[model samples]
Target: MIAVRRSETTLFTSREATHDNDTVALTHRAGLVRQFGSGLYGFTPTGERVRRRLIDAVDAELRAIGGQRISLPQLNYSGIWERSGRWESFEGEMFTFENRDGKRLCLAPSHEEGVVHLVDGAVRSYEDLPALYYQVGRKHRDDHARNGLLRLKEFTMKDAYSLHADADSLDETYERVRAAYVRLFEALDLAFVVAAAENSVMGGSASEEFVAPVETGTLDLRHCTAEDCRFGVTDESPGWASVGGICPDCGGNLVAGEGIEIGHAFKLGTRYADAMDLTVDGPDGDEWRVHMGSYGIGIERLLHTILAQQSDDAGCRWPDGIAPFGASIVPLAYEGAIRETADRLYRELGAGETLLFDDPGQTIGERFAESDLLGIPRKVVLGNQFRETGAVELECRDGTTRYVDPDEVAAVVSGTRSGD
Candidate 1:
């Protein structure tokens, strides 16, 4: 129950916002985010609450699948990149700088090199064949940073690395991680598609990207419509448009749609192992290289995509599992029985954990406006009807409303109680 007073909050004024086809204008107008620089934004109290909810959902999904959470240094030594043969190739896009000691370093845009080095020192025997490590932290990139959270100079990423002794083991682990991502997105109530992807700079034989369609997205994918078919490929592939968007596997016609790429999984095989001489004692007493895979979810980009997909003329409509607050308590009349009923309902909703108590200083209209702006899934209003008929009105973000007893408001919002 997070208590909030509209008067005390510093939300973005309408005049301070500019409309765009993405989340920039809506989020700012609602006072959820504030722009600090190009591709950089600051989350307000309300925004941070939503962000944490998203992080918590992803973190739980990762841990449930044998992923051990670990933190690595953001500033990495250039020696690591050089050993991996990406130092020179990545020069134009790596954030490189020299320290006072003349030691070369760069903020890691990804953790392939770091993960390989860390795992090399930890696992020395075949007994540690299958190790899954993950970290949720900040990653820096030299991207041109555009389209709100779609691209940024700095962002948060949940990256998981798996080490295996054989190709079969790597494949199994990759599928498991991919399934975990499916669950994470389902929990977030995001509709997405998994499509074959190019490995590009992250040297690997195969890759797949999890994408969600949005009007302002930059990636275009052509998907097959054949029954039980899941084939989707990037539009950049040669002859994709000329083939009438055909699915290579099923010979089905493809339909093209634009989507924002949220997650990617790669089968890295022995690229890093061979480059860095990463090895362990095999079961037969011979040294063998490890097979690896990398999985990543762009935290900020995912959140922005969700908001863009779920938002409407009102504001953000967060899914139940990731909403900052389950519901809001708006008291139409600040005094008399109305306030009493509202106060009782607020306390019943766990006193700030599951419900938001709108400030009484604002008018009913003002409270409703703020309530809609924040997009709380359920809104309990104690107004004239409550004072007259002893029934409070429950309004959903979708504009559905019904009257219910004040004592049952909390349970109703929490999905524990049923009926009007």
Candidate 2:
């Protein structure tokens, strides 16, 4: 589909990369986990915690929009692929094959077909004109492959499609989705650009990519260094935006940067509506083609992106709301009764305070070394002397150490640490 949005005035505009103060991913054992990709990552309880927190934020944003996550099957058949003609165009980008029955199937590359198949069965009127359907599930791609989890063959993604009655209706949904995306990224604490983008394959006019730039992210975007620009961030994806003396949405000055497109929203208009003959009868009994748009965000990619942007050198530093387990309990002892103290402390830590007990069989050096690798924010050293003093030597991954009493452990975890 032809891009309908008017092009910006600038030529050869350079995209700026993200300026995060910190970006790190915590991996347990790499180049050693046989059969896994080089960057193939399996989240530690801590890493998983970080991923879930980001996911919860996304889902909460979706739920606020009355959207929900649904699962789509991994194997989708030839009928839809042939129907969309994606069977031919998808090429190496798509993972496709056939079973004994000779049905062309894919790893359900995208749910556009699946969703369309669903819509094809139910809605018959413009009263059903505006339907927004979304899913958070695994998607398959014949990826170019990469380091870490940036680009993977199989990963989670969120695809939302909106069906509307007219251009104005589609535009409204587009704007709402766009706003939600902005809020969503901001909530994740990453800088992103909403650049005017080309709908490479999804087939649409006027698309915007919500790119979040990280030092080593797979997606690249150009944006402004000055974060105050009201035009939001210009996407260097297809790179279009006119910068006059003033901002389009505000009077603020304009600036730029590079962005990693974590999300994209497209105004399909009647492209799919016409392709699939999705005409609906209006409440006034008028028949009209449903105007449509599709929004997509790679969920697992987002998880990796969050881990990329949010962590420190130690490990995945997940935000409090999303850490898989809140605390990592490391029992660093070189003396008597250390084991018993750790056991006692573990039993009495408090309600819902998840901890990983590192009862040392290794040297002090090994225990400390592992602590850096297993980066739970707050590390509680269950030492022998703790029971006497009524506290443990608390080590923070953010670089602070102290004697935290049982009473103050909650305080520290509750973020009361002056050192945190």
Candidate 3:
């Protein structure tokens, strides 16, 4: 069981860091993250728990689709980028520097060139054609990072690359990955739209992005408002018709909104493979350049988008699978019978999944506020009601309250997985 104490963690209030963005303000006040610099932030313990759950969810989806998880180097030599003819193209956005030996190096903003270089000679035949490699790690960029985690100089990303013998094979994997991304976001309960996106720097034949609509989002998107229509397009896409334009598929009304891009899928179509000489011999002994696809999901950006859409004036309201703790045991007073009962329930409900509010200094109202601020899904209150009737007050995040026998607490909370 991971135990957390209020006094042991750094939590801010609304009075600190006066910002116009409510999501940013609530993030700090909830102790989810701490900003180190303009574009850099570190996750607190509470935040790390939620992040791990999100990452695990992503991993499960990708792995189920035959994505082989691998770790790639964060720092890349200029030779790889130059060979791919992207060193100069990515000049301003990539973090480039000259090492002590006068050789230029860069913190990779994306791993297309480096990943291609890593598998250049190893994959020598069509049998090694459909290779899907993915990694979760830090990616660096030189953007004007602002709006909390929406834009950051350094951030965590889940990037996957697929190599295929031909465009048809690449298309097969692209659709699979696209489906997996939809399932992932759906499982997280995020309201998002998958839109045709522009292949700008990544340079691909086609691309699509999973965008979550939020007021603080930077991407402009047009989506059909019809219940049956799922048509959407980014403003930068070639197929983008202006807002109030007719929906190409369903002839529905298209509305414009701001959205954050959480995931992107690209049909690279031999762009990197040809530029970097990633080739394989065919069954007929002919040399063929491998086609490629790149997919990415910004981890922190997804987390922030959830907060942007789900948080209320009280605090954050985490989705089912990503809450930091499944249930919190908040006793009105931690003494005598209340303390013993709360401790017993914590153990019965699985200590790791349940948070016991053991701090005695605060009143019951203060404890309830703290529990709501943390966005715990369920609150098990051992109060005067428990003392009189042996029934614990069960409060859910949706503002519903009920009283259940002490023994039924575990079964009720166990209906969902904890922090998974």
Candidate 4:
């Protein structure tokens, strides 16, 4: 069985960042429901489950790549944009203001400028080349936003930038990160395609977007049916025949689809270094503009897509991988013998992972529906009248119901494979 979270902790807190396991994360996600506000979230239990899972997956992947989230101020450095020639173009869309010192400042739409400036302040030579710095933090945009969390004015982003000495080193890290992004999305159980793309708005020569195919997507993808090819994304209007060579996995024909762009990686090719005067002395003692690459993933968008992909009429059936609570246990009867037995079983099962024990006051139907809407994967029904002796009712959201012994839950949990 996929390991699950045991409890929730404060966001960006030292403990939350350090606890990388499954159970604690689910509890963490369960806690997110409390903070979701009027502008961005509707707060469905299943949605929270999906959101937590996606974040956990990406956070884990970034750690594997030697990255971590770091906090910086929400506003700073108006001159930095002017130095980069972005000050005018970014005018309205940037959340700008004058600081107490009368210096200009703005909220960051992207972290490239901030990261570059920070590194420039820290490094002075070849030894600092290939320094990788990343942060998963809140970002803001001043544009109109109404697409749920998919397009929010303020959201969380995981952005990493690598500074390199040689083009070869940059390329190696580039591909390494591409692979990392693939695995990150895969861990979240998202179907995605890394497409060759243009830095149309960003004005870069090299770039690609990791897109997830969703009905509400804004980007397009083309893939071929040829037996030997497996390409899916291109910036130009190439027909499927040209872009897709074959389905590398099964040799099946490939097709084109609209995709929601979620993550991206780009080669800066000294663009930002030049704009910001971020250069380091080379081995020959010559000043060299550091080769740079920027990679980003919208953590909130992943949450949105996860919700769109797995939820249904009854509610969400979040996979065990991401569910905040492994199961929502409801003791059907409250008084006398049943309550006592159920309370005992709940304590026993609670020992496994995070558990939201629904007390035995609501009717059976209410309990079941609430559990369904809450989208917890498994439901343990502790009713004294269970026809079977020495066993409680175990129900999976994926239409699995069984009268099972409480002690055997791990075995049954192991058998499920629906999601997250």
Best by lDDT: 3
* Candidate 3 residue pairs in clash (backbone atoms < 3 Å): none
Q: Candidate 3's C-alpha lDDT? A: 0.85
Q: Once all C-alphas are superposed, what RMSD does model 3 give against the true structure?
A: 2.1
Task: List model 4 lDDT by residue over 1-420, tens digit each.
Answer: 222221222221112321232322332333333335422444344345456566777778878887656666668688777877777767677788887898988888887777777777568888877766777777888766644566676778888888887677788888888889977776666767666777644545588877776655556665544533435664432233354545545666667666667888998777877778888888889998888888888877766566556566664445446765667666665556555655565555554443544443458676677666556677777765453475777777777678877677556655655431
Mark the 10 consecutive residues where model 3 has the least summed lDDT.
6-15
Model 1 C-alpha lDDT per residue in residues 120-169, reported as the tens digit of each score: 77799978879999999999888887877779888889999999988999
lDDT of each: 0.80, 0.62, 0.85, 0.65
User: Higher-TM-score candidate among 1 and 3?
Assistant: 3
Q: Which tens-of-lDDT digit does each residue in 243-288 have in candidate 2?
A: 5445556565544444456888888777766667777888788888
Ranking by lDDT: 3, 1, 4, 2
Can you give the lDDT of residue 65 in candidate 3? 98
What's the TM-score of each model vs. the native? Answer: 0.93, 0.79, 0.95, 0.80
Model 3 TM:
0.95
- Model 1 poorest ten-residue lDDT run: 350-359
Q: Which stretches of candidate 4 lie over 4 Å from their true place?
A: 1-53, 99-101, 221-230, 234-256, 351-353, 357-361, 384-387, 410-420
Model 4 CA lDDT for position 295: 89
Number of the predicted model whose TM-score against the real structure is largest: 3
